[model samples]
Target chain A: MMTFLVRRLAIILPTLVFVSFIIFGLQQLLPGDPALAMAGEERDPDAIAHIRKTLRLDEPIAMRYAYWMAGVVQGDLGISLRIQKPVGELVLQKLPVTLQLAAMAMLVALLIGIPMGMLSAVKNGSAWDYGANVIALWGLSTPNFWLGIMMILLFSVELGWLPASGYVPPAEGLGANLAAMVMPAFVLGNAIAAVMMRHTRSAMLQVLSSDYVRTARAKGLYERAVIGKHAWRNASIPVITLGALEFGQLLSGAVLTEQVFSIPGFGKLIVDAVFNRDYAVVQGVVLCTASAYILLNFLADIAYMLVNPRLRS
Target chain B: MTALLEVEDLRTSFKVESGRFQAVDGIDLRLEAGRTLGVVGESGCGKSVTALSIMGLVASPPGEVAAAKIRFEGRDLLALSADAMRDLRGDRLAMIFQEPMTSLNPAFTVGDQIAEAIQRHRGLDRAAAWARAVEMLRRVHIPAAEARAHDYPHKLSGGMRQRVMIAMALALDPKLLIADEPTTALDVTVQAQILDLLRRLRAESGMAILIITHDLGVIAELADDVTVMYAGKVVERAPVEALFEAPQHPYTIGLLGSIPRLEREQARLDAIEGVVPNPLSPPAGCRFHPRCPFAEARCREAEPGLGPVGPSHFAACWRTPLP
Candidate 1:
């Protein structure tokens, strides 16, 4: 396992280098000069030139890239041009909220989607199955932004059940933070749950037809045992993959969701940086999200090994 | 001796886009206490379907027990509710499937899968049930029973997994055990061992077994009574000895001839010609007419009903004129 981890990490090195090159190139190509944006239009040319030289803007792009790469190797993520703060500090400040939202959304998806999918598979062709399919279809088809608007309207504006926008740290109190985060989480979660439930249903249907399931039934197992114990566990292999992909997507997929909920998560921070042309902040966030996607996929592979003993080979 | 299981006019079919396909057409079979009744037929011949319908494990969608009366110890099996059927399965009756490799759940420990039925039907607690599972495993001659119980299905060899299947089926000492090609997937030596174990278990438990297979050797070795199925219907049935000595139906004779016998010297074993007819559009008269060497004009026009040919031998063939 350690060897496998080492091998994966080795592969990730070149990928990170490639990603940094793209982020550096794309920021360089943006319309407005950071020197002008930083110093303002009225600043003296000499003063602006001095700031550009200090920021290494006057240096060759290759030289600038080498310097940035060296700093990255030394655990320095560079400074945010707009905020004039360390990019790492800005990322650390916003990382927790995005992680919490993603975790909550995934938890909600698993709790709701797994059972719903099992029900659809178990009661197959019945009204409950039909209902679950319709719900899944709606969840998959409806845009997250539209769903977020409806949630805000129903839960916040109309029912006064939750605050319409903004975030509260869990340190403030568990209930308050949950209430603040839930609407955004719901918007993202419903969409993920739809995908997960469909996967679970299809996987379970396949497992249910296996000869072992027939043997289980021949042993006179109750329908619940036949499904929950036998079919569900076998079906979980695919569901686990879906869940991990959805989790990775959450950090980015929640960008619009975060905007609608007015939560200042990493997703929202990245969106803000893009519009304000904050190169350092955008690079840091992109790097972090990409790393997360790779790491979660690795974890999914491990989870697959854990669930299916046959894969130990 | 009183019969333990009697199935009469049993029919099962599946609904497809084309039409209804009758899998097990009208067939009658009986099993006396402590005896084996082997129903022999090739794949798609409805032998397994009959076994599943008997256990009420038939997948409902696209499949149904179209028509039948199945009786177990004078009680009507079909008349029972689903809940009641559940009670009967694994308690009074149990079934072992073909493909032992796939018959046991890959996710579950072999011991837990077996213990589940024991606890559910016998009302044993977890500890006692587990102990019984190990004991049953030992009975089936699986090596290192106590330790091996903790292992999953994939961890075991094909033969050992088959032993576990038999152990699970026999956990409750069911009155009637339906073994549907239990040894089909095993190697020849392993097959012999399993067949030997089954014969011994039958003797010890005095349980009536309905063994489904297309292997004449298996039927000859294990079955006291034999039923030959052709295209969803019973073509012939008689005591194993009598049927082999003098097969009344042409299909049975063809089947018996197809097997290479150690006792008989021949230039070449007789082969049954042609394939089984599609069930949806079976032959107008005798379903076996297309394949039967003795096919005649009447054989293709009118379906021959099963009737007694000898004292206990029954056949469905018009070629053999009625007495």
Candidate 2:
């Protein structure tokens, strides 16, 4: 297991390097110049030249890349010219907020999706099966942003139950933070729940028909024990993979859902950075999301070993 | 003595997209305690379905099983509630199936699976069940049962896995064990070993065994009584020696002929010609007429019911007293 972990880490390190390279390289290709963006309306040539030299825009691309990477490696993500703040500090501010939202969304997804999937599979060919599938279709098809808007209108405008838009830090109060974050989290969650439902349903259907399931039945197990204990254990393997990948996507898929809710998270930060041509903040956020995806995949492999003894070898 | 199990007019049908078809057509089976009854047939002849139907493990809706009476220890199984049936199963009745490699749950250790059954029916605590599982494993001749109990299903070979399956099924000391082609997936040597293990276990437990297989050789070795089926109907049934010595049904003769023997020299191996009739649309008259070489005019006009051909033998053939 240690050897496997070492091997996976070896693969992850280079992937992160490649991802950082892409982020930095893409940021370099953006049309707006940092020096020009920093300059005011009464732009002087010498002032611009001095700013360019200072920012190393006049240096070789390789030299500039090396400089950028050195700072990134030392936990410096340069500075967002628009906000005149360190990009690393901006990312840190938004990370926890987004992480909390993503976690809540995933929690809602898992709570609803897995059981529904198992129920659907066990009650296959019944009305309940079709009903769950129909609901899943709606969840999958409806854009989360539109769903977020509708939820806001119902829960906030009509019912006056939740805050319409904006976020509260957990430090203020976890309940209040949850109240503020709930709608957007659900809007994000329901769509992912649909995907989880489909994956879990199919996985369960396959497992339910397996030879071991037949053996389980022959053992005189109650239908519930057969489905829950024996079948679900095998069925959940694929769902685990889906959950990790979905969580990784949730970190980035939060973009539109985040936008609609006015939650100050990575989505809003990145959007503002892009519009303001704040390349450093965009690079930092994208780099972080990519690393998360790689890390999630790595964690998923470990989870597979833990859950399926067949893979432990 | 009263029979351990009495299955009468046990019919099973499967509703498929094409149409409904009878898989086990009005079959009857009787087994006495401390005896083995072998149900032998080619694939698609409903032998496995018969076993499943008896065990109440057949999937519903697509599959349906009905019988006039399926009495186990004088209790009519068909009259029992679903829960009552479940309580009986894996307790008074246990089953092992073909493809032992796939039959054991891969997600759990072999020990956990066996222990689970013990705990479910025996009311044993976790540690006691675990100890019983290990003991069961050892009884099945699995070497190093203590260590092997910790190994997952995949860690064992096909034969070892079948042994594990037998261990699990017999953990509760079920009165009747229905083994559906249990050794079908093992190699020849392993097959013999499993058969030997089963015979030994039967001698030890004095449990009635309902061994389903397509191999007459297997029936010869392990069975006291044998029922031969063809195209979803029992064609012949008799004590093992009588069936082999005076096989009355043509299909039974065909089945016995198909077995390659070192003693019986032939230029070419004799194989029963023609495939099994499509289950969806079996023939109007005798189901085996299309495949039976000695099929006569009366054979195609009407299906023959089981008739006494000898002192203790019955056959379902119009020309059973073959010339």
Candidate maximizing TM-score: 2
- What are the per-residue Cα lDDT tens digits for candidate 2 across A1-313? 6788789899998988888888878877788877777787868889899888877789887898788789988989888878878998988899898899999999999998988898899999999899999999999999988999999999999999999998889899988898999998899889989999999999999999999999888888888889988999888889999999899987863778888988999888888888777877888889888888998999898988888888776
Off by over 4 Å in 2: none
Residue A23 of model 1, lDDT score: 82
Stretches > 4 Å off in candidate 1? A1-32, A60-63, A73-75, B66-68, B263-265, B321-323
lDDT of 1 by residue, A90-205 (tens): 88888899999999999889988999998898778999999999999999999999999998899999999999998889999999999998888888888888988899899988
- The DockQ leader among the candidates is 2
Write model 1 residue lDDT over B1-323, tens digit each, in one string: 65788888988989898999999888888898888999998788999999998888887887888556688988898898998898888888999888999989988889999999999888899999999999999999998999999999999999999999999999999999999998889999999999999999999999999999999899988999999998889988899999989899988888888888788899998888888888889878888888877889999899998888887888899977576
Q: What tens digits encode model 2's per-residue C-alpha lDDT throughout B154-197?
A: 99999999999999999999899999998889999999999999
Reference-based TM-score of each model: 0.94, 0.98
Lowest lDDT sum, 10 consecutive residues, model 1 chain A, at: A1-10
TM-score, first chain, each model: 0.93, 0.96
User: In order, how many clashes per candidate?
Assistant: 2, 0
Q: Which residue pairs show backbone clashes in model 1?
A: B25-B232, B285-B302
Worst 10 residues of 2 chain A by lDDT: A33-42
